[model samples]
Target: MNAPRGTGPYVDAHHHVWDLSARDQDWLAGAALAPLRRNFTLADLAPEARAAGVGATVLVQTVTVADETPEFLALAADSDLVAGVVGRTDLTRPDVADTLARLRELPGGRRLVGIRHQVQGERDPEWLLRPDVRRGLAAVADAGLAHDLVVLPHQLPSCARAAADHPGLTFVLDHLGKPPIASGVLEPWASAVRALAARPNTVCKLSGMVTEADHAQWTVDDLRPYADTVLHAFGPERLMFGSDWPVSLLAAPYGAVLDAAELLTRSLGADAHAEVFAGTARRVYGLPGG
Candidate 1:
């Protein structure tokens, strides 16, 4: 049998890069997000990732535009840093499977590991359970791609149900379902998370806490309870680290995000740390190299 995989290199399982000159990020129109209105490229992230010891990254989708996935795939094809991409496609369309197939035929198509929709923007909390959405999820599973869930706490039950319905598809919960860190409330979110974790096919990203918290006044202790809850619920094997990058810049710098993640998991043993920082992402995303 093969030996256990040691902590080879950290994998940033989630993050985003965008160019404003090419297209408008409608989400950035608000003044609160004005700081991120400027373009952020892989070039901007490379040094910060390297300094943080992150060797590979999964560049995630920002907008729901059809062209964005191909752009991300091409970016991954060109960059040594971006190992995989979780891109966007309209899940309600009848041609989604074909679209996924077409995307795989693009420049960096092979680097496409998963699909994501801005579920948080949906008015319906049970959007994932919609028949058309469920059909799209089946297509994603058939394509051997995971689905990234970027939903809020109340929507997590739908996430759990989606995971249950599509056992073949891996449901990666981004930002631990975006917990209420700022308010310091854990109840329904924690309970919903535990329920989702019980589904076995689900995974959670240990990222985005800083922004979820009161950006300026947040402390590690403030995040500890939530972190501990996921650690207990999903365990390190099902949890991966992410920087959330320039978006995370709203609250803290890249190094600080990585530092916080390191501190949060410091109590874990080396093997568990290996899983959270690297192995889980590698296995979950089918990323190449360490």
Candidate 2:
């Protein structure tokens, strides 16, 4: 299928670049994650992104380290392909507001459009509701930045609660809350996603599905149900397309990922297609010309 097109360059709302030499990505230690241990730089990603017709991309945080955000901001500052960054900071810190201020003051800091944490690894399902975390979330709202939720399905209830508690903050759900596509189960995850979508402040990214499914044999049909669920729940306006690249390479090439997203949303009309492929991301991230 042809890649999805819109009135403007498609905004890839989620993707990442990491240099293993600068710092080890401890998560890449497993044998299953071996393919990603090497360096993935913007230079490597830019040509492919360009070929995919992606004009602007949002660089998302991969690790929980505070230093990573500044480094990502610096990278965004220098790159034309990267128009925004969803970075990481210690949200539990008492001085999170000040930390956010300091981050914003850094080079390319204006490109810091959002914040994210490894909420998927947390033991406590209610981690988002913890007093310290909630305080930090409020600080994020005060700074006029969004929070990216990279959580597992079971933890989604807390996500809904957090969104309810912080109506001013936009919660961008990454990877459709990491649904169980490999097993073909969607009930609880779909229901939970709908509940979260009930909050007007929440948004969902149509990303990471290729990796979530049976990597070697998955098809666009396998991803359609989940995509349809979010499309119905959030509608095109609150939904966005994300390549989830490098990580997405585990299951399919960058172009194949884009192709699958295009196929899944092919049923929509021209305007809805534009919203899913470009418009939603631009507005949600507050990117240029949004």
Best-performing candidate as measured by TM-score: 2
Candidate 1 colliding pairs: none
- TM per model? 0.96, 0.98
Model 2 TM: 0.98
lDDT of 1 by residue, 9-83 (tens): 689999999998898999987888989999999999999888777899999999978889999999999999999
Task: List candidate 2 segments past 4 Å from native.
Answer: 1-8
Stretches of candidate 1 off by over 4 Å are 1-8
Looking at model 1, how many pairs of residues clash?
A: 0
Across residues 50-113, which tens digit of lDDT does each residue of candidate 2 receive?
9888899999999877789999999999999999999998889999999999999999999999
RMSD of candidate 1 to the truth, in angstroms, is 3.9
Model 2 residue 174 distance off true place after TM-score fit, in angstroms: 0.1
